[model samples]
Target: MSGEQLNEVRKVIWLTGASSGIGRSLALGLAAEGHQVIASARSDVELAVLETLSSNITALPCDITDASGLSFLRARLSHLSSHLDQIILCAGNCEYLDFPEPDWDMVTRVMEVNYFGAVNCVKTALPLLRQSAAERPHIVAVASMVTDAPFPRAEAYGASKAAMRYFFDCLRLDLRSEHIDVSVVNPGFVDTPLTQKNNFPMPFLLSAEDASRRIIENLESRPKNYSFPKRLLCLLAVSKILPALWQKIVLNGADGKARQDVLNEKVGE
Candidate 1:
């Protein structure tokens, strides 16, 4: 659909992970645009604050990983509004694997929140989206651009997002027959609570508000896949083309030492 057409419709959108970061900013942005937003997150306190900020937003606090809770959420959604026109599934988690006996359980933990959680949300939202009075209902999943290029210690985070991305891609095809549009959003480094913990550098880092604005604006076009920060995209593309060199450059430490060299330094100390 054209931007003009997108502007014409005020949608009922359920935005998950509305407690903080991109989800929080995006919820406000969407609400500001006059959309009836059912804001969701695991934190009741945060959701309450979000609701107080704008009448356009309603707080629905629930853990996305809880299947029983999602059913209850569907009931709450029905009570709040007749149908859902769109759903922006932004709920995710990240955990880096520490090498030299990495925490294998972290893989399950990350996948549970990022991948399986998304799958559960889609199942819960599909019925509501089908009831949409709008001509076409949309599903947008907020994935990470880490899938474009591998990063050290990001085994769990990147793998989970990559799985989510592929799931959405397949869903896009299957849902086409039903006319439910699916969009996978892959964002580069953004200033969020999750990223603040990283000890390494994050190039092209954008504020959550800026990222939200870009996401909300681009969703107007309903592109199947949206990835941004063009410089990072180009870099990842280069990585894809020349993997060995990419690894050499990226795995090199902040002080121009290779990862092995850094490890050796630590051992010597």
Candidate 2:
């Protein structure tokens, strides 16, 4: 048997942000592999289309930020399956803090989706995840590599992802005794609708398909954290070892035009 098949046990997976980008690709990939996928998104129409693509996928539209509405979401989810063997918290959003008169509200907005939304999913799924028959159920979140280095105008997006990274890290420790595993996936720039509007150059930009494939392949190992592509991580490493040099790169020139271009360009992160 193939390693992929050997690892496959036909898990019931709940995936958020299923309407587009990485979430859409992951839904298709997991469903193609014969796993049952309960895909959620606020875009009910898009979720409907995704459901038609595979018998293995069931559309469960929801607003992850809706704290009060989660009881309804959970009830709907319970109606779909007895338990969730795994959950991929892929639902996210990005908003930049542009120069001068930046909208400070973007910080709260970004946190609502990328951080609180993820936590909400975990809150709703814990009971179901606990009921899974798998030896160790998995909880996964798709954060961003932007947290590795500070970027101008990326204050909101970066802070939200950094918060997400830490939350999952702590959750991993708490869940260890229950044999439930948690993993945080931090991907560098990927070509997606979210990044399509980015005007700056994205080094090592991978297509959504390529990014999804890498995520699927690596997730089987259930590492506490996974960041990619390797080259991008290496590039960001300079920010840590050589803070002065990093500042020179980001704060160069009176206008700091280069750094501005980078943040607005990568709002998707």
TM-scores for all candidates? 0.90, 0.91
Error (Å) of candidate 1 at residue 98 is 0.7
Candidate 1, 1-269: lDDT as tens digits: 22233334489898999999999999999989999888988899999999899878888888988877778877777777767899999998988998799999999999998999999899888898998888889999999999999888899999999999999999999999999999999999999998988777576789999999999999999999999987668777757888886787578866534654533342343
Worst 10 residues of 2 by lDDT: 1-10
> By lDDT, who's the top model here?
2
Instruction: Give each model's clash number.
Output: 0, 1
The alpha-carbon deviation from the true structure for residue 69 of candidate 2, after best TM-score superposition, in angstroms, is 0.8
**Each prediction's whole-model lDDT (CA):** 0.87, 0.88
Please write out the lDDT profile of model 2 over residues 104-201, one tens digit for every residue: 88899999999999999999999989989899999999999999998778999999999999999999999999999999999999988898887665
- As for candidate 2, its clashing pairs are 198-265
